[model samples]
Target: MSFFYNYSANNQGLEIEGVQGQSVFSVAKGKVVYIGDTFKNYGKLIIIKHANNYLSMYGFNKNIFIKLNDQVSENQKISTIGCLDNNLSKLYFEIRFKGNPINLLKLFPNIKLKQH
Candidate 1:
């Protein structure tokens, strides 16, 4: 599917605008298979395995509320937005099929944030 950010700032992974304590919701039904902080640029991260062998990756979260193997529904709250090492709040989202990253924006045209 498509990914949507709640803000109008730059869409770059490092430049995205994420508000602290804001809930990060699941875009679709899936099973959480990974949840933890990354050692590098990703910060906190979570991975959800969806139907048809699709996986959604949510990174730069302040906290991960769900655990591995947890079933999550569409729009379900999963985590809170976090920041980089520089302390800039941002969420890095991705959709993958099998193991490859897919451009999710193509799937949700209506929800895309406009460029300023």
Candidate 2:
């Protein structure tokens, strides 16, 4: 998991470094709300809306397996990790509640985010 930074800093997500083409999974069961790279600096991004006004985001994907409005299950493979302009393979993951970013590490204390 990445270090914490205030929302205004634009560091609202966790960067999970991994090998190129590694699988990326949905954090929970949700409906795909957005699927595109239009968001600046978030390459090939996918957003899912979960219950109780929660949202999950997966970014920097090499390939996306699901489409917009797709109902995805927990742990479902959504995409493959992609490289940024610097050529580093990573997945930018985030969770939000009511439009505010939440600390993932605090929420899943025992979960491992890094991939080798």
Q: Among these predicted structures, which one has the highest TM-score? A: 2
CA error at residue 5 for candidate 1, angstroms: 11
The C-alpha TM-scores of every prediction are 0.76, 0.84
lDDT of 1 at 28: 100
RMSD of each: 5.4, 3.6
Residue 15 local lDDT, model 2: 75
Tens-digit per-residue lDDT, 71-93, candidate 1: 99999999998766676577778
Evaluate model 1: give its TM-score: 0.76
Residue pairs in steric clash, candidate 1? Answer: none
Relative to the true structure, how large is the alpha-carbon lDDT of every model? 0.73, 0.84
Residues 1-116 of candidate 2: C-alpha lDDT, one tens digit per residue: 33332244654677777889899999899999999989867799999999999999888899899999999999999999998889988787888999988877788677654433
User: Whole-model lDDT, candidate 2?
Assistant: 0.84
Kindly report which residue stretches of model 2 are placed more than 4 angstroms away from their true locations once superposed: 1-8, 109-116
